[model samples]
Target: MTFGQQLLFFFSAVGAFNGLLLGIYLLFIKKLKYLPDFFLGLLLLMLSTRVGISVCMYFYPDLPRIIPHLGLSALFFTGPALYYYIRSSFQQNQFDVRNCRKVFGILTLILGAVGLLYLFFPVTWENYFGTFIYTAWSVFVFITVYQYYIFSKQKIVSHNKFVLPVLLSNVIIFLTYQLISTGWIQVYCAGGSLVFSFVLYANFLILFNKKYHQVAVKETNNRYSNKKISEEQADNFVSRLERLMETEELYKNANLKLSDLASRMNMSAHQLSQLLNDNLGKSFSIYINEYRINEACEKIENGSYLKIEEIGYEVGFNSKSTFFSTFKKIKNTTPLLYKQSQILTEPRFQSSNL
Candidate 1:
């Protein structure tokens, strides 16, 4: 083989080894045990197996033909596994067997289709069919990337800086492999493996970092669970939480999250959520909005002379419609009507005082 081919082979081998190590660490060494971590491990395993086989097939062309078919089958899992990994990482839902089954079922269908095509068709026809399958996989990657983009904008999940870039790298690598027909497939494959290995290692370092572990440990301990707390304890906790909010005016932060508030109260997000739901009979949104709406009411009554929308922004409502709806819902009157009532009452108060 030429020097270029030798270089590709070396990179591919290194990538495969790195992937294997990362898969093991994700599956075993990572203590968080989140569903995303499991899916990520599966993704790495599939990637390593697929890349390793590709390299082996190139180096030793006489290998059994079935091996390549198996590698292609593994390719079908990459897109879906990555999609789920990102979704499960950002989402708060616990692992659901039904979701896992759905992903597995899609993968099974793809593999079965590819297997049947290989069995019945000529080699050239099988290659063509495999191309179509990979094209579909590329589409899957596109959709998953789009979903991640939308989710990031919603701010409902913690953003991982590496997830999007890693996913886009897959899309780019696959497109490069498909589009460049001048025997550059090996180059793209080798480069892709290198990139994937780098991302996996970086993610491993981030996940198992000392700071992250310490924070996770503290958060796990504080997380609100079924742990029994006395009624008095619950009340005291609520009082402290309320004082923190009132004194700090945390509700004024438009982007404030339950977790953020919980941290300020020196508790877990789940605990704060439970306290609001069980003790206060409100969700976090309602609790925060109550403070905001009350502040808006005072501004309106005092004739702050600001536009209603401006007042909404001042009180931490991100949008005008939300401010109007929340105010109406809680106060049972529009902001304008409330202001009018206050204006009418002020004259009566002055006359009575006179």
Candidate 2:
């Protein structure tokens, strides 16, 4: 490679390498258990892998066949990671964790099958499978943008300051790849990698700004600003809270986060937490999980056709393990055994229903 090309590769490759390290830090080293952070780490890792491949092929045309395959494989997950990160960062019912995991599982099987084919028929993978990957990536990018459009239209986008730039950057990268794929631009793999480098660093600055840190600190300081509520106020708040739970069935939403609930109730999250802890003597999770477990018990006793996991999803628990453990904690037995006991004691419910 000429010096110019080598320099281009160095700058671009540096970005990809730095992004990889940052991604690893967020995924494994970060102490916070934030779901958005996890998804963002996965996104950065996938994008870095894809860009690294471009950097290699741009500099080394005679690279091993496996490099291209791995690059394209990473592209498959890149779009999904972006989609899931956006979904996880928000508290909308449309972006349930259960659905996110379901889509991820489907994508895994797809890429797994494609990977096996690539191992045996390299030419087919290059000609057809590569196109499929680009197509899938394009579709995912479109879906993510469309989903964001819906959120924007409904005025439900709380974290747009962070999400918009990511969406825009991915769209540009997608457009660049499409241009190259369509032969509009030739031998611009390095250009795409360069764009990834820019996007990755820009995201780093945007996400890790000092302003966000101040926000976190301010929230912590304000958590106990005025924790005490009068008896009448507490009674009214509880009544409204219960009414909302019963009528709106907010607990049915798998993405009904504590912050979102506090916003709906016209209070800060800390205030809500104070009320929950001081007055109700329960943490937010236990309170919400109690409702979900009760609903699961009702569904199990009703002899619903849905599987146990499905029941968990229906009651707003994101996973079967959470539902089962919460059920055991509250009901003192497993769901299946509880169902059997109910059936034995009330045989009419079993016979008359079906």
Candidate 3:
């Protein structure tokens, strides 16, 4: 009838539908670890609880209140769940059950106790918690963004194609939400003033689901079809190759080839080549040189007695020109420049001496 009523009905429909999708994801989707699944479950519960509260607020304002600010209470878990969900999605094997369960229990107790208290004494509570929860979530989000920034600057997060989309989605969700809340040109909700959390919620669900499937497919591929080298095995092999290259013994082997490294590791040349190209995200020549570049940088910084050329040769680089080019490509700077700029040196070598 009224604008507010129409807005309320619209949100109610979105809330119910989101709750249904979340329920399906939780009940049916198999996870690699309990933490991710647990976090997802909590996330869904929060969405459902918020939807219920919205319905009551819109239609039955006079009904006995069980949870004052149920929607706000749900917002409290949003940040923590989001953080854990992203982490678990990336690192399925390292997902710890105890820590995850403990965090979930603590949040549940805090929110559930507050909800029950509000139900019994609805007049005692206030709306200050809403702002508090948002501020807290903002802090969590910024921390993750900062970590990603560090990784990018260090060149550790090389796949900017994937990372950028994920980060952009989060930024969009954050900016859209703030705009909707502030009543500054609403681009999301159709009916009225109430911001549709469901849109952002669906965005997150899709993002996390994509990440989950990526990990799941990799894991499944590794388990089956021993005849063909799976994606996960290739990834694991590259990790092992990196670790092997870290050792002084391994780095000393100049003129090393894919077949040579494969022989050392007891793997076939085809497998190693495929692993380097597909999973490690580099060609064989580039991958090997990147490792050498890292080693050369370390040696140049710490072992001041060793000449740059000597260090480069020891790390499997054939010539000074090749070493310099590879180092620049991987580190985004020349070996000499990187050493002078990044490495910790004695005060005697400081710019003041110049």
Candidate 4:
């Protein structure tokens, strides 16, 4: 094989290997909901990009144009799935069929349209459609980057750094291909640059995955370091804590403190703090406040009919102003507004299912 062919082969191999390893890692994490769908989408993207390049070189003119169409279509899932995965990470629930089906449904439509178009088209038309598809692909990626920025603003740590480089690399790759098609660049430079772009982008993906996984593992270890429990044991402990907090009234005590809770749970304060911070992804104060705020909101909106000050005091707030500020920060609105909305919605809810 020539040097260019070898380079293509290397990138194809790297892309495949990265996809395989990443899929395995995501599957095994077991904590990330909807990870399987995200991994499957990404694997399709990797295979599509690699195989598209191969078809362009070795099989072009002889290849059915629909292959490239299928490949480019995979880009939609790869970018959007990454954003979806990030959003899902913020919630504790497992990923469900309803959400995954939404993505697959859109992909099905795109693929169906492309196939119908290809069947009625000629070679020149297919080439034009390919360029159009590439343009659409680029736009899709740009939108994903923007959406990811919004999610990162909500404080996802991994996305906080990785989106920019990957976004830029993808744009550059698309532009290089466009230039080549327009005959502004030599064929070799165009293809070589595109391959190089994927390689760099793949490296960014690997680094991002590494940083995220390392942080997750470190946080998990910190939570279990004192008793040195296995990861499964630590997960069980944290799961039990979550369940107890939800079902038992013990955590609702106004006098509850980190040390007190730790002693009751037969664990050290440091360990408890780690579990709250790492596993639950919040500081101890924040975690406690979340529960307190929810309880206060309940009293305010529900028939508890307590005064704001009384609700605050009941939920462990030292002062009404403190409760007001904390509640506003968490719920992004004033207590009175929340109460008014709840009041207006109550009759509708009572009369019919919400």
Candidate 5:
């Protein structure tokens, strides 16, 4: 190969090869359980395989035909993985890892199906696979851009500003290939590889920027610490929790834990804690105590034979002092005073108590 050709090969090959390595590291070596990381790894793997195959066939046109087919198979899922990576990145922390695994399973089935067709009907694949792959890719890119537009319009609090470059990168790579395929750009056979390498490294630089990490870490922490769930989400969480409380009387168990409540709500313990603190404007303990205090009030009104002290234990409090203090704070009166008021208002209670 000529010197310029060698240079072209070296730069493009480096990006594709290193992308493969990074993809493997993120998928297997990195221990993070975050959904975005896993999807990003998969995206990288797909793109790397696709780009590597493009680079090889462009430079050495006589290579095995199966090499291109292998790369085409990767293309089948590339768009889906890209879209998912962005989606997962924006998802709330409660987005379950199990769900992501399910997505992965579905994508794998798609890839396997495409591979089977490629194997059994190579002629059909050679004729139509490229159109299907590029069309899928273009649609995903458009969807991603549309997502950015919606997010920007709503001013959704996230790192979507970073997505702009990624969107542009993919657009450029796609256009480059489209131009070459249409014979509009009379360039080297590896022109698509050239753009792919450039964009791939641009993404790498964005990822490695110190300010990016600082902002990302800060934003993530700030989200959990300060950001409340959307009103809709908050309402949904409250309704679900209320239903659980009414049906199960979970707070009646003195040993009831935050994790237990969160599990009932299908959320993480931290998510429930955040919900209580930010959305409900209370701590988990206080939230549960409010339920207990209300239950205590109902018991007092019902002319229960048990004394206030026993009623406290019945409701869930561990001690007389705590129950009395919490009742006064919640009800704005001592338990006995509150009970006497109930007796005065409700003749039945007075009759039963007397």
Candidate 6:
């Protein structure tokens, strides 16, 4: 191999190695064990393995035959891992055993089928399988991108601006590799190793920034030590908040944000956040959504002619899925079920009157 080829190989190896380590650290060492973190870690590990093996097979063709198959298996999981990571990032529920079983079962079936095919089929057939895998992966990526777009439109609080850049990196890597595979580009050995490196490092930087902000907040809190307020002040804040919501019906705005509410109340965002957390012991989302859910219940009980989905939207939910999920979470039952129970009670009351 020429010096240029050797240099690319070295850089690719370094990226893959660092990615593998980062994935392990995220999975094992990260204190906050969020489900999304696990999925992201798995994605990073799979990507590193796939890239490392591909680089190895290119530089040392005499390596064992099993190496390529292992890499292909890792490649097969990349899209699914990424999709789940994005999905779980926005979810509020804790990851449980049931979720683990479902994800693992599906992954097992896919890998098992691929393994069987490789065991029985001619070596050349694997190329056809690669085409199908990549095509499916592209479709999944598009679906994920569309999901995020919808989230953005709805102004979901969990939608992180950083997620877009990470997703874009994935899309770019996939497209560049696809172009190279199809002989549309002359780049040597699947481009975008540096891009993958950038993404991994970017994640680290985000994490660092978050930690730094937390520490800074802690220091400020220690110095001020006077965030507490009297009961009268708390009541005043609560009354003002309620009056604003009652008068303006701001809760009906599907895209309402904490900062928007804070601005309307003539308070700094941090002050508003602290008031909610310290006084009410509720996050802004929970407090706002409680009002929304209460309004939904009133609509249901009043026998409004609107459909359940319409009622959800009218009460400020941005999407039917989110509305149902949050309603179930807060109300301890689904909207349709709650409405049906209310209807049943109404008939009993009418019969009693008769």
Best candidate per TM-score, number?
6
lDDT of each: 0.74, 0.80, 0.61, 0.61, 0.77, 0.77
Q: What is the lDDT of residue 98 in candidate 5?
A: 80
Tell me each candidate's TM-score.
Answer: 0.54, 0.63, 0.45, 0.50, 0.57, 0.64
- Rank order (by TM-score, best first): 6, 2, 5, 1, 4, 3
Model 1, 1-354: lDDT tens per residue?
899888878876887888878777887888843567787787777777777787787787899988876776777777778888777766533335597788689768867876786678856566675676577568778888888888778854442445665666566656654554335445554555555555556656765684686588666866646675567878998899889777757777676788778776767777778778887889999999999999998898888979988899888887889999999999999988988899899999999999
Better of 1 and 5 by TM-score: 5
Give residue 147's lDDT in candidate 5 (0 to 100): 74
Q: Count the backbone clashes (under 3 Å) in each candidate.
A: 0, 0, 1, 0, 0, 0
lDDT string, candidate 3, 1-354, tens digits = 589776667665675557557755774675523445655565556545555565555565686544536566776776676566555544443346588779779877876776666567656654545555567667766765776566556544221123454455445555554565567974434322133345545556777897797567546644652556677776677677777666424544444567557656656666677676667667878776766777687777675677777677767776789888878888889877877775556565776788
List clashing residue pairs in candidate 2: none
Q: Which whole-number lDDT from 0 to 100 does residue 267 have in model 4?
A: 66
Determine which window of 10 residues in candidate 6 has minimal summed lDDT.
88-97
Candidate 3: stretches off by over 4 Å: 2-12, 27-41, 59-64, 112-124, 150-354
Off-target runs (Cα >4 Å) in candidate 4 are 20-61, 82-100, 151-183, 187-354
Off by over 4 Å in 6: 1-6, 29-32, 94-104, 159-161, 206-352
Candidate 5: C-alpha lDDT: 0.77
Compose the digit string of candidate 2's lDDT tens values, residues 211-298. 6875775587586557588788988888988887776667867667787677678677787887888889999888888888888888
Which ranges in model 5 have alpha carbons more than 4 Å from their true place? 94-104, 159-161, 207-354
Q: Model 5 residue 258 lDDT?
A: 88
Tell me which of candidates 2 and 6 scores higher on TM-score: 6
Most lDDT-accurate candidate: 2
Better model by lDDT: candidate 2 vs candidate 4? 2
Q: Per-residue lDDT of 1-354 in model 6, one digit per residue for the tens?
A: 899988888877888899999778878888754566777788888888888888888888999877877887787778877777776655434225477569668877977886787778848566866676677678778888888788678755443335665677688778876787788878777355655666667777887897797567656655644567568887898899989888767787666688678767766567778788989999999999999999999999888999999898788887899999999999999999998899789879999999
The weakest ten consecutive residues by lDDT in model 1 span 180-189
Off by over 4 Å in 2: 1-10, 23-42, 59-70, 80-132, 143-167, 183-188, 210-227, 230-269, 278-286, 300-302, 306-354
